[model samples]
Target: MTISATIDGQLVQWRDSKRYLWLMGAIIPLIPMAMWGLYALTGSTLSWYFGPFFVYVLIPTFDLLAGLDPNNPPEELIEAIEEDRYYRWVTYAFLPLQLVGLIWGAYLLGGGTLPGIEDPLTVVQKIGLATGLGMVAGIGINTAHELGHKKEHMERWFARVALAQTFYGHFYIEHNRGHHVRVATPEDPASSRLGETLWEFLPRTVSGSFKSAWGLEKKRLNRLGKGPVTLKNDLFNAWSFSVVLWGGLMIAFGWEILPYLVIQAVLGIFLLESVNYLEHYGMKRQRLESGRYERVSPAHSWNSNNIGTNVLLYHLQRHSDHHANPTRRYQALRDFKEAPVLPTGYAGMMVLTWIPQVWRKVMDKKVLDHYDGDVSLANVHPRTAHKYGASLEGAAA
Candidate 1:
């Protein structure tokens, strides 16, 4: 049976392994909401705490708190890129939750309907909420990362909306065509240099991706002979959309409430950028004779396969295979023997990235191994000889 078939438990006339992954990836957003829903339904303070703590503390800790070790037992599933149906599905399921969260957040900001808790979860509840928002921030971008790569207009549009919610929409463009292509080299601003710290990477990634989105879109627009993407383009629209959307919320609620939104979005983007800082930390693409970077190989990006996070996150942590084959679904993306493996999952790696020196100290050796120092324009976008092209027959190019 095909990988996606195993996940969806059904066949497809024109499907690969992505059905389950896409289906699952869309579900991550609903988790916190489900928790919130239970709290709402139960009308209990403890219930409120349950949702946040699990999302914030428990789920994120699978990799970080555990120190990212997954004891080997079952290699029962090794998903690949094309089977991202699960990944995409989770994302789809999660979106309505985002809207609900936004509405709830707006309500809280507006002082409309935030029910008073009975004090059972006063402290833990707060921590859970914070962590929940943090996860929202983190997962928001990760979703954008996945959606941004799709060729569908709806996918790209949803990705933009998600990014805008987090105030990091530029990632949609810069990541898909820019960073993933030029990563590990000086050309890509998102990828941290060998000696760079995570702190230094933050502003650069934030600003660079934003501006590069314009450039990337411009390339596409120019290719199609379109006008400037100032207002009509989704990239720029994210900025305007958020301004009005949040502004309306502030007017409805209070300006003070805006801080929560900003903080959460900032934290979320940081969560993602920190991960970007980790992936390809010391790796660079090889130059080929045609003046392009070599094929998207396992060596180009880092990989991690903590079972819990891998399954929960829709295998995003196994990035090497995803980058190696951009169109591959997340479910089918797997750990390749040749690719480098991180010691922990994304959450753990993210925590590790906070301490720049410590992160460098830990990952220094791994980075050095894949450093391709002598790259030039003579070697960019290297020809990929692998058979990834055959998989693009159905959904998109």
Candidate 2:
């Protein structure tokens, strides 16, 4: 669809080339069903692990093959594209499918058999299926992210529903009110530091974000003369959704599925944290005269334009625009030329994060270059400050 707007007495027309491709994100939740179908056909355990293979392998390969998509809608047409209800509907569709997938996965994990299989799955296969479900749970968090940023009440609630699968409901509170406010600063737990491996970042972000979310909610509720434990506390309320969902699933599927549930939830949390680790790795906003960090800008975030990951992740690879305009719909996000570009899409970069040496080799120079070789300007991890000729005081400053 071509959208036109008049700017300075000139007609400007823009068409979103990836309009339909956005549907790929909604299709992610159906991977478990695909897993079942593949298993039914092939009877191979490999089919059960397809979700991880698809996300970690096929998506990265696709990113390399698909290359970049530098298209940006005309400034005049951003609102037009944002208001197009079709885009939001696509995101809404993901929630139902995600719920269905989780329920179906639970049934399978509980030894329930479907039409295609006369025999129950093996323990190894169940573990593979759990990992696959973890992929959906993690990606569902991304879907929740897009919804959580919206102003609509329903969308915010939908965000909580999506998060229930991963037991990460508190992210809705922390990401919007906590991380966004302090991003690229030492205080922002979600922002990764230079020389911090993914192994090191995982526990920090997970635990820190939970604490930060609770604190934010407690402060908010205190103003209303309410305790943090109340349902009115956003953190408490959000977490309740996870408790209720998981509890209900356990009741329905029996207690034996508990271990698999934990496995998927933990893996999902790891996946989300891995993305957080990469988003602002080694980037820091400077302090102002008043001892406050400078406002976040395009420079504070790493960005990618790889079409495959962009489509799969709902343009989340355009992190610069997302931080700059938090409420902007995914379809309307614009790429900034000034933003630091990653070597490839997020999927490929996530793979690099597993090998800290390889990650540092690939990204440390990029950080240095982004700061014009000023080591002190980067968010250098205090322990590795000497490696970069930066004092611990300067790195922590």
TM-score of each: 0.72, 0.98
What would the per-residue lDDT of candidate 2 be over residues 86-118, giving only the tens digit for each residue? 999999999999999999999999889997777
What RMSD value applies to candidate 2? Answer: 1.1
For residues 1-397, what per-residue lDDT tens digits would candidate 1 score against the true structure?
A: 3432243564423233334433544455555465567777886646544533554456567555434422221123433333435446666666667666765655544445444433333444434454556567577777677777777788877777676667776676678778777776657877765556788778877888877888888877777778755566757776765777677777776775666677667767777887788777645565579988666677767778665566556668778767776765555565677787887776667667778778867776565444433222111222211112212221011
RMSD of each: 9.6, 1.1
Q: What is the Cα-based lDDT of residue 276 in candidate 1?
A: 82
**Candidate 2 segments whose C-alpha is farther than 4 A from its true place:** none
Model 2, residue 280: C-alpha shift (Å): 0.4
Return the TM-score for candidate 1, rounded to 2 decimals. 0.72
Q: Report the number of clashing residue pairs per model.
A: 61, 0
